[model samples]
Target chain A: MISVSMTVNGKAVSAKIDPRTLLVQFLRENLLLTGTHVGCDTSQCGACVVHVDGKAIKSCTTLAATCDGASVVTIEGLAHDGVLHPMQEAFRENHGLQCGFCTPGMIMSAIDIVNRKGHDLDEHTIREELEGNICRCTGYHNIVKSVAAGAHAMAGSK
Target chain B: MYAFAYQRPTTVRQVQSALGKHEDAKILAGGQTLLPTMKQRLASPSAVIDLGHVAGLSGIEKKGRNIVIGAMARHAEVATSEVVREAIPALAALAGGIGDPAVRNRGTIGGSVANNDPSADYPAALLALGATIVTNKRKIAADDFFQGMFTTALEEGEIITKVSFPVPAKAAYVKFPNPASRYAMVGVFVSKKGSDVKVAVTGASNEGVFRAAGLEAALKGKFNPKAVEGVAVDGSNFIADIHGSADYRANLVSVMTKRAVTKALGK
Candidate 1:
């Protein structure tokens, strides 16, 4: 077993995990942080999306040990003191989910995009960028709207 | 994923030693492709050496007339690097237009080139730009590097340290991506080095990335979009898959090639 240590949601966390254990498995199984979903293990689905050192990555494809001493932010970390992040609020307000299995990853990826691209996103660019995050529900119309709204909200604060 | 010993080496010498120590070891650069294969039980290495902690293997450097990119450099880094942008704008555009933001941040050039997935984008850029693959053992030209589908000239335990690409006078990449997977269904990279021109096509050929001699020859005669208008390549050498038929990919090769040339010419 490989001993791994990293900061998760601004908290230092450590675990002795198998070398083959994926970051998603470590988060869900070892750390008990299950807000990050695992839709497809093939890295095609962004259901396991999370921030590793402030950059979005597919947790299913990242090894737990590889993230040693790095910072990771997941869906569970998005809420602060009962206050939902603007992206989460927008997702909820816009009804950006159906099955909700892909919500966590979608929101994570959306927040990263907004953090990078900001509120100036167009419909086609959003569609193209969100290709990694698959949502079999809502047909992505509302998801796109939610991302736009969230970006607008964030831009206003900035 | 089978149980294996994992080690994160912090230096190149340590990486080389670890590789030499482990008999069936796999160097883990970006896990975008390898981990997925392992999850499917397709690859079960006895040891997985993580190169993430290797300090010097993750940056972009400009040396003389060449852009020396670390093998472990992520796509996003390359996409946004000032050196890459100034030296080869098309390369930055190609990197920026890879899978997605997340994949761009995680997938590394070494991982992509080492994996050599037929539909990958970096191989096309490397081949067309006449890049050299630097390994721990030796340097191999892009022409002789890619052996076959999901295969490379890298020997067992051979780790790719970096790739050096010549600064092209002008270059561009055009790809018709598979809508679902975001991998290139047929991608073309057109590059002009001095007076010589090279066109490399990926994601369409059965033997992986190969130069389009007809297009290259045409562009060599006249480095303009109009020069490649009447050139034709045998479409019999492309791979057919669920996303596109052989003929469809063949047709896309020509179209994408033309678009790439046009884009390179800024027309």
Candidate 2:
């Protein structure tokens, strides 16, 4: 077993995990942070998206040991003191999800996109950026709206 | 995923030593492709060496007339690097268009080149720009690096440290992305180095990314989109898959090649 230590959701966390353990598995199984869902075992599904050192990455494809000493932020990190994050609020307000399996990752990825690209995102850019996250339901009409709204809200705050 | 010993080395020497110590070791660059393959039981290494912590393996630098890119640099990093954007804007756009935000953040150019997937985007750029693959052992020219479909000239245990691309006078990449997976169903890279013009096609050929000699010869005479108007590429060696037929992909090579030239010319 490899001993790994990293900051998760702004808190320092450590665990003794197998070298083969994926970051998603470590988050869900070891830390019980099941908010970061795993829809597909392949990297195609962004259901396991998280922020590693402030950049969005597919946790399913990231090894837990590779993130040793880095900072990670998952879906569980989005909420604060019973208030939903702006992206989460935007998703809820815009009806971005139907089944919600891809919500956590979608929100995480959208937040990261806003953090990087800011509020000038267009519908086409949102669609292209969200290609990594697959949603079987919704056909992406409302998801795009959610991202745009989130971007607007983010921009309004700054 | 099978159990393996994992080590994160912080320096190049330590990375090389770790690689030298383990016979059944795999260098983990971005883990975008390798981890997925491991999850599917396609590749089972006894030891996985993580190169993310290696300090010098993740930057973009301009040396003389070449753009030196660290192998471990993520697609997002390359896409956003001012040096890459200024020197090779098309490369930055290509990197920015790969996969999505998550994949771009995690996938490294080194891992993509090492894996050498037939449908990847980077090989087309490297081939067209006449990039040099710098490894721990020696530097291999892009022309001689890619051997065949999903194959490269990299010897076992030889790790790629960096890639240096010559500053092209003009360049662009055009790709028809797979709808679901977002990988290139067919992609073309067109570049002009001095007076010589090079055109490379990826994701459409069974032999992987290769120079389109017909297109090259045509463009050499006239470096414009109209140069490829009547060119016909032989589909005999093109890759035929569910996304497109060999003939269709062959036809797309011309179409994408034309579009790439137009884009490179900023038309």
Candidate 3:
């Protein structure tokens, strides 16, 4: 077992885990941060996506030990002071989800896209950037809208 | 994933020591490909060496006429780097199109090239640009670097430090990606440096990524898509998966080459 420590949603957390423990398994099992889903553990489905140092990544394929000193943000960390993050709000307003299994990862990935690509995201760019994320429901029409609204709202929130 | 000893070594020498200490060890650069394979139980190393803490292993900058990228530099860094964008927009675009936003954040150029997945994007760029693979042991040309599918000339314990890509006068990579997995089905990278031209194909060959001598000969000095229009590409050696037939991939090699040449010419 390896002792790993990381700041999760602004809280310092540490755990003794198996050397091969994935970050998604660590987050969901060890810390009980079930907000991060594991739709497909093969890294194909982005249901386990989260922010590591403010960038979106597939937690299922990453080792928990590799994030020893990193800061991780999950869907649970999106809201602050009883207020939802703009992206979450936009998802609600735009109905970006259906079965909701892909919401957390979708929202996390959307916010990171806004962080990097900025607020003026076009439909084509959002669709292209969303290639890694798989949404089995909604056919991505609403998700595209949510990302656009979220990008614009995020720009204002910041 | 099976049990293994995890070690995060901060230096090249430490990594060497870790490898020397464990006979069955695997180096983890970006974990893009390795982790997936591990999760599937296709790879089970006794020791998984993490190179994340290694110094001077992740960055992008211009060194002389080449763009020097640290091996550990993430795909996002290369995709969004101003230096890479300015030096070779084709390379930047190529990086930007790999996997997706999340995958790009974690995947690294060194990992991609080292793994040499048949469908990977970087090998085509490396081959066409004549990039130099800089390892802890020595600097090797791209021509001598790739041996075959999922194989490289890198000896055991030889860690890739950085890669230096000579700025091409113009280049572009065009691929028909598998819609779901995003792995290239048949991709072509076309580049020209002075009077010499190089064209490399990925995702279509059974022998893995390879240079297209016929297309290269056609576009040598002309640097035009029309130059390769008449060239014949054989289909027998191309990969024939469910995504495409060998003939179709061979056809894509020609189609993608033409498109790549047109993009390289900025048309």
Candidate 4:
């Protein structure tokens, strides 16, 4: 087992984990942060999306060992007190999900898209940027709506 | 994934030492490809040496006439780098189009070239842009580096440190991606430097990424899409699969090349 230490969702964490343990496994098993889902462990589905050093990436494929000194943020890290994050609220308001299995990943990825593309996102850009996150529910029409609203909400909040 | 010892090295010298010590070691650049293979039990390396922490391995800068990218620079980084955008916008566009947003956030250009997947986009860019692969051992030109499918001139224990690409006058990459996997079904990269022109095709060849001499010769002086019109490429060497037949891919090669040259001209 390799000893690993890093900041997760504003918490400093250090644990003895198998050297081959994936970042998603560490988050779900070691820390019990299950919001980051693992729909396809092969990196095809973005159900394990999370922020490492402020950039969203697939956690299923990233080794926890390689992220020793980095700052990581997951779905659980997004909300403050009892209020949902703007993106999460936007999803709820816009009916962005049906099954809700891929919501955490979608919310995380949506935040990154907003961060990179800013609040003036178009439908086509939102559709193109969502190539990573796959939702079998809602046919992506409402998800795109949620992202656009969320981008505006995020801008308003700031 | 099988149990393995993990080694994180901070320097190129340390990478060499770790490789020398571990008999069956695999260098991990970005886990986008390697980790997935390991999860499926396809690769069972005894030791995994991560080059993430290695110094002097991740950045994009313009050096003289070439755009030099550190080996560990992520696709997202290259896609967004101002230097790459200014020096070679097509390269930035190519990097932006690889995989998805999350995969692009982690996948490195060096890893893509090292794996040399027949469907990868970088090899087409490397070959067409005339890139020089810089390793801890020595520099190998792109022409001498790619040997065959999933193969390269890299000896065991060698680590790619950087890649330097000559900034072409204009270039563009046109890729027809496999819908589900997003790996290129056929990718064409066309570039022109002065009067010299190059056309490279990836993902369609059974032999791996290769230059299309027929298309290059036609576009040498004219450097236009019309020059590539009605060009017949031999489809016998193309890999025929359910996604596309050899003839289909051969036809796509011409179409993509023509589109790329037209796009290059626009740039």
Question: What CA RMSD would you report for each candidate?
Answer: 1.5, 1.4, 1.0, 0.9
True contacts kept of each: 0.93, 0.98, 0.98, 0.95
The predicted structure with the larger lDDT, 1 or 2, is: 2
Maximum-lDDT candidate: 4
Model 1, residue B137: distance off in Å is 2.7
Worst 10 residues of 1 chain A by lDDT: A149-158
| DockQ, 0 to 1 scale, candidate 4 | 0.94
Ranked by TM-score from best down, the candidates are 4, 3, 2, 1
Sort by DockQ, top down from the best:
4, 3, 2, 1
TM-score of chain A of each: 0.97, 0.97, 0.98, 0.99
Over B15-40, each residue of candidate 2 has an lDDT whose tens digit, in order, gives: 78887888788989888888888888
Computed on C-alpha atoms, the DockQ of candidate 2 is: 0.90
Per-residue alpha-carbon lDDT of candidate 1 for residues A1-158, written as tens digits (9 for 90 to 100): 87889999999999888888889999999889999999988877899999999999999889888998999999999888999988999999999999999999999999899877878889887888898899897899999999989888878765
- Give the distance in Å from residue A144's predicted Cα in candidate 3 to where it truly belongs: 1.5
DockQ scores of all models, one per candidate:
0.86, 0.90, 0.92, 0.94
lDDT of 1 by residue, B116-219 (tens): 99989999999999999998889999999988788899986678999999999999999998877768999999999888899999999888988889889988
Please report how far candidate 1 places residue B82 from its true position, in Å. Answer: 1.7
Please report, in order, the local distance difference test score of every candidate based on alpha carbons.
Answer: 0.90, 0.91, 0.93, 0.94
Backbone clash count, each prediction separately: 0, 0, 0, 0
lDDT of 2 by residue, A1-158 (tens): 98999999999999898888889999999999999998987888899999999989999988888899899999999889998888999999999999999999999999988988788899988987887888999999999999999999888765
Report residue A82 deviation for candidate 2 (angstroms).
0.9
Q: Which candidate would rank higher by DockQ, 1 or 3?
A: 3
- List pairs with backbone clashes in candidate 3: none
**Candidate 2: which stretches are off by over 4 Å?**
none
> Per candidate, chain B TM-score?
0.96, 0.96, 0.98, 0.98
Instruction: For candidate 3, write residues B1-267 as lDDT tens digits.
Output: 788999999999999999999988999998989999998889999999999999989889998999999999998999999999999999999998888889999999999999999899999999999999999999999999988899899998899999999999999999998876779998899999899999999999888899999899989858888888879998898888788899999888989999999999899
